[model samples]
Target: MPVWQTIYSELSQYNFSVFSIMEDKNIEDARPWIEKSGAKFPCTIDTNHIISDLYNMFNVPTVVWIDENGKIVRPNDVVVMNEGGAKLVKVDPETYIEKIRRWVINNDPPMNSNDDFIKYKQQREHTDNEQVARAEFLIGQWLYNNGELELATQHFETATELSPADVMIQRGTMSMRGMDPMKDYGPIAGNIIKKGLRLYRPIRD
Candidate 1:
């Protein structure tokens, strides 16, 4: 978030726009954090995970680059923020920043296209299981909003079981149970690690 702030500050002079979506958070729940961040750019909430489904986002902090033609140049990826932020994942912030600059200047060069983007899009083509998981997740969100914790938990658990690879469902369920989905070192991490899963699975092109 700090890194995004820095980028926003730096690039505000250019023809750049930056916005963020807080998946799994309602507008009320997200307001305090948004205000605390002092973000100038517009931020929106995704209480129903609609954007997640559309974008095929399974994790938080995923970035997608869109061109002037409204075409996706870059699919979702774990964007390393600043040096301190990158330390958590052992990525060089400078390298990531350089790539961003190149993309900005070159406008997503054709030669630099990533195959993973296509692969991820295809994978997100929504199998029957995925549709069921999505339905369960939406129902869980509705139940949570209506103050039905037990019922919501049941639906969320079903969603997680149906879509084990989707961190959005898993973390959304955790957040409802008063857990810190992003920061807290919790069982979700252990479960994914035990299954030999990449925490930030790259979106295939």
Candidate 2:
């Protein structure tokens, strides 16, 4: 809902309104932050998570910009950060602000969807493994927050099983493996083997 938040933040000049938050699922937990962030805007809760999941938001802070008929002009990653446009490569706060201004005013996206980005988006939809990875990460986050370091490792291990290549899962796994240099490289060999098998084995196999 960053788009809506931005729009509402400038409603006096732009006359835009935030229609909904559309958060369904375990997001009921984030209500305090939502209220604090959206003190002036209208917000509602969704228990089913239908819209968020349909758009493949495995986590918080996802959004879509829909036209009147509900066509998506922009899908995922549409919300530009209000961080005052920093330079993408070497962005200062002023540069970030300028970027944010450009994003809010421009009708077209700064860049077209490239082949790699399209493939990444497709990866989110095409792989059940990714969803499973999300579940693992969520569980791991819960475990970590609850002071269950040993228990959290199990969830992270499940995430690695789900999406061995998922960066978030990899990062979490790395954090848990901190200071253990030998363990650090263990997954790399397994990853190489997995990649090799995928390359050499027939698709049917």
Candidate 3:
């Protein structure tokens, strides 16, 4: 959030817009955090996980950069802009900010030609299992909202098993029980760190 706050403050002179989507198990649960951040940009709560399904989001703090032409300049990636947010991931936040500034000045920058951007889009192409998992995850969200804990748990579990690579479903399940998914879910955290996967798969120049 500090990262986002920084971008919102520092980049106001540009014509770009900055907003956020809180993709948690419940909006009420996420509201306090959003309020505490003192975010100036628009923020919306995603209850149905529809954005997650559309973008193939598997983690928190992912950003998608769209240009003035309404085309995706960059796919979903981490947009950390401070040392604190970069501590756990060991990424350089200033590097990302510089990229954003460059994009604002030059809409069709050479960074967009990078292979990682292509890979980011390619990664979102779901397989058969992932598609099934997404359905189960959505069903789980509906069930959980309707006060069916046991049935909801079953569906969420099925979704997790089917799409083991998707962290969002696993985190959603944990959040429903008021648990810290990143700290508590051993397998998910291990996979993220061990595989050199992007904690937030942002494009790098």
For each candidate in turn, the TM-score is: 0.84, 0.44, 0.85
- Tell me the whole-model lDDT of each prediction, alpha carbons only: 0.73, 0.50, 0.75
- Candidate maximizing TM-score: 3
Candidate 2: stretches off by over 4 Å: 1-6, 9-32, 42-53, 58-62, 78-124, 137-149, 164-205
| Residue pairs with backbone atoms closer than 3 Å in model 3 (clashes) | 77-201, 77-202, 78-200
In angstroms, give how far residue 18 of model 2 lies from its true place. 3.7
User: In candidate 2, which residue pairs clash?
Assistant: 24-46, 84-96, 84-97, 85-95, 85-96, 85-97, 86-96, 87-91
Ranking by lDDT: 3, 1, 2
2 versus 3: better lDDT goes to: 3
Q: Model 3, range 26-115, lDDT digits (tens) per residue?
A: 778788989988888898898878888887787777888887778776777775555676775555787777877777766547355667
> Best to worst by TM-score, what's the order?
3, 1, 2
Q: List the residue pairs that clash in candidate 1.
A: 115-205, 116-204, 116-205, 117-204, 117-205, 118-205, 119-205, 120-204
Candidate 3 ranges with C-alpha deviation above 4 Å? 81-85, 106-116, 191-200
Question: Worst 10-residue stretch by lDDT in candidate 2?
Answer: 196-205
Q: Can you write out model 2's per-residue Cα lDDT over 38-139, one digit (the tens) per residue?
A: 546767775433443356553333444454455654455422244532222122434433443454465434224545445545655636776776677667
